[model samples]
Target: MQFKILQLVFLFAICSAANAATLNKQVRSLDWWQHASFYQIYPRSFKDSNNDGIGDLQGIIEKLDHFTDAVVDAVWLSPIFKSPQVDQGYDISDYRDVDPDYGTMDDLKELIQKAHAKKIKVILDFVPNHTSDKHQWFIDSVNGVEEYRDYYVWANAKVDDDGNRVPPNNWISNFKNSAWTWSEERQQYYLHQFAPAQPDLNYRNPKVVQAMKDVLTFWLDQGVDGFRVDAIPHLVENEELLDEPKSNIPGYNDTDYEYLDHIYTKDLPETFDMVYQWRQLLDDYTNKNGGDSRIFMTEAYSDINHTMLYYGSADGSQLGAHFTFNFYLITDININSTAQDIANTVNKWLDAIPEIYTSNWVLGNHDKHRVATRFGVANADGFNMLKSLLPGVAVTYNGEEIGQENGEVSYEEGQDPSARDPAIFDKVSRDFERTPYQWDDSTNAGFNTGAKPWLPVSEKYVETNLKKEKADPVSHFKVYKALAQLRANPTLISGDVTVKAVDEYTVLIKRSLNGSSLALVFNVGNDTATVDIAEDVSKSNKIVLTNVDSSRDTGSTVDPSNLKLEAHEALILSF
Candidate 1:
């Protein structure tokens, strides 16, 4: 039969030239987001291969081989679109479709071609700040329907003198009230920063920026390789007309969340020209798509030199390099207060931007609390909750590497109605950081042998699973895969560091590439601590890595004239 259809067209051109030689070897081998490790996945409590307790997209393509030996490279995902999950799926009503309760857009293109055939890289969480008041362009622009009624952010009575309706001013809505939602079918006054069923989407329209660039060019033409955005610097508001900043409230009623300072409607500056025009529309759809590789992350709750001045802000070209949320505002572990809290968050991300700007560190997200939510016991030493901050890129939060904590639920066992706060919904149930993802300790922990589970499965992660921590070796998933293979070694991902300290309880960082050299030593105190090191730290010191055991118990007490450190130990020398 024509040689069996020419042997199925030469085995489909050898599987498209082995998927374009694995995305051009992950675009000349990974470094855009400096040694990317990312692994977030909160698709409705992640995993329910048809036992119907949600979590789909064919249960993330049947666990892409559980992150093919994790400490994984990339997989962001959260917000499987088509939402009415309200704030779940970040309220979008279809940013190029998917949500049939999380499946089909061809099962998210077979979970992005089986997570790029296992070299992993998927991304997609894009909530573009707001949508879903059952989004059909916000119900045809709240019914006045003038070509989808100006896309959203409406307001008519700027203090209506006598017509009376009022709501074009006193802003607010970080999740309380008045960001205006009076929409009586075009009776004007529509914007809903959040929880007016999440309306806010008018980046002062241009057909709503060509309808969100045709819904991100329908997922980079069905191959989505980037975007973590959700609430990106609150998509541009506050175009002057000022008036906030008053209340050092140290007295009375000090908690309307301490008078929310979303700095005049969020880091404005036209929200960095709407993220440098969604990064020049995903860099012209990956330059006419071939071997896709794109990433435009954001979720800036600001701070880190104003989030590295929103990376190339508006045609000085910046928008897309936001990896903030700094460990959901601290989960502390003390390695010299975690290397001086990531050296003051990498010196405010290198003194406010422009060094080819980019930064990300997420830590444990699904809205905080779960790095054993403050040591209720789990791997008790989460290399700073598996992120080991230094300079951007590192997400980690799926049972946070065998150390899953926080899961006790009761408000009749909730499932995030934003932990229920619909106008002060005190049905009470907050931090248990979304739950479910045990991966096997069976019974419900397998995530579903079904006996109820839409959340619940952190029985201290029932003996930390991934098949009993791949059969333990002082496992925190083998120290997050030996701290992400020495933080993606090769002189630790584009190196350049110097922190020295041969004193006050030992510290020495040193990492130089292309000329090869490395040093790590960090034993911040608790019985045993001497000092003095850089005389070419010798005594044949070569312990390369140590969180617990590799035997040498402090490099036979290393010495460049007396050097020690054995409590919360660390040392990674190579030269």
Candidate 2:
């Protein structure tokens, strides 16, 4: 027994030294974003400055300290460019100018400088797929200007036997309408994959491509670190004016956007090339100008195979995006999700991702329902732990750290374009998730001092707000901060990840670096889970972090051979 104990002690010492050496070597080789935590801030719902009822750039600037306090390494603000507010800020009227609703151009420059000073990289939303109909280029195209006529996809109307003019094709808009709209001035039908007010740019036009590249350079010159390319799959479409096949999904009709397969309208081969072009532009700019890497976080809501293409060529020769936003964790896991279900979703991406490129995890975003609301409030921190512990970037939406749920918003109070149709408002309204941030228990949840916030504040804000959570010793916000700190640790940053379903109720994730191993065990079911992960983690048995709903405490010892996890609980154990 004495000899066995001595052997274990000597092995432990060697592992510790190996961990230190591996950490030091890998820390210097990783990029600034490889292991960083990225927080997404929706400008309209974040905070309201000047009391105009809408959030502005100044509001985010004021909240910079909050990001630093949370240890967020980078933040991506959703579309601050000038727009008519048709699709919030997604409809870009001017790529170079800051919207008057948000702030001035000088305000943006100031934000970039201040954010950099705080060591936070700033990524602006780049909407290259389309521009608002009110934009000068679109207006010029409508007026038949020779140079701008082909700036957007325009085709002649199809004349039927009845002599009635029909849209060029049967493609549907994401807004549940015909993709083509008649331009009275030009007497041509223009394609708008999103809302009719937002016309898709003709990327086939070299001029349009060059113009968009110039817009990127303009923002780069302004000192913005990078861009979150929005609606990337819609950048280009099948040019042959073809009709899409019916989706044939039950309980849906032709009137619904889901009625069609969208094969011709989405995930086209040309779209990948377009993304590659933007990636080249970003890399070229970084090469010419000496600075930290300017990355692209392309937003492509497609299958895992197509999504991975955004990372670059399969051979990994050509560089595409630093990381494509992975939504598997967001769209796949929910209230009834089992541990095996989660393992499958995560492994699907992990297996498909090329060996050279990095991986990413996203639980929620402005467009989706809050994780607490979607995955059950009890399971919020468990999923958050999974996202953070995964061996790659972790993207967080605002208010998620505090376990904010979707607010109640009626059809009459809804502002989202997709929810405009009252008949299906409840089914499609994003207004619930886009409600004002719950800062404190004050009026308007401390998001605005004005008479009213642009959107209603969640009534539970009084109890669920950040102020309330911050005071709690065990809270979701505390767990998130702890995860953020752990993100910087070498074992997490450079370690290899191994995930498995311990049982139907529990999932085990192990990150091992050199000899040190850290384990993250999640109990996603509704009962106590007794799991034995001794084979997975044998170095240490100290609980380093616990979910907000966990009954266990950090710094407590646990027997790897027999670990107890409460329902919806997650624990990070260092071994």
Give the root-mean-square deviation of each candidate in angstroms: 23.3, 4.4
Q: Mind sharing the TM-score for model 2?
A: 0.95
In candidate 2, residue 29 scores what lDDT?
74
Which stretch of 10 consecutive residues in model 1 shows the poorest summed lDDT?
Answer: 1-10
lDDT of every predicted structure (CA atoms): 0.64, 0.86
How many residue pairs collide in each prediction?
Answer: 5, 1
Leading candidate by lDDT = 2
**Tens-digit lDDT string for candidate 2 (286-393):** 999978999989998898888988888988777788999999888877788888999999999989998889999999998899999998888888888899888889
Candidate 1 global CA lDDT score:
0.64
Q: Per-prediction TM-score, please?
A: 0.34, 0.95
lDDT of 1 by residue, 130-226 (tens): 7888878888887866888777777775657687767766666665546677877678777666678888887777888777878777777787787
Give the best candidate by TM-score: 2
Give the least accurate 10-residue stretch of model 2, judged by summed lDDT.
Answer: 1-10
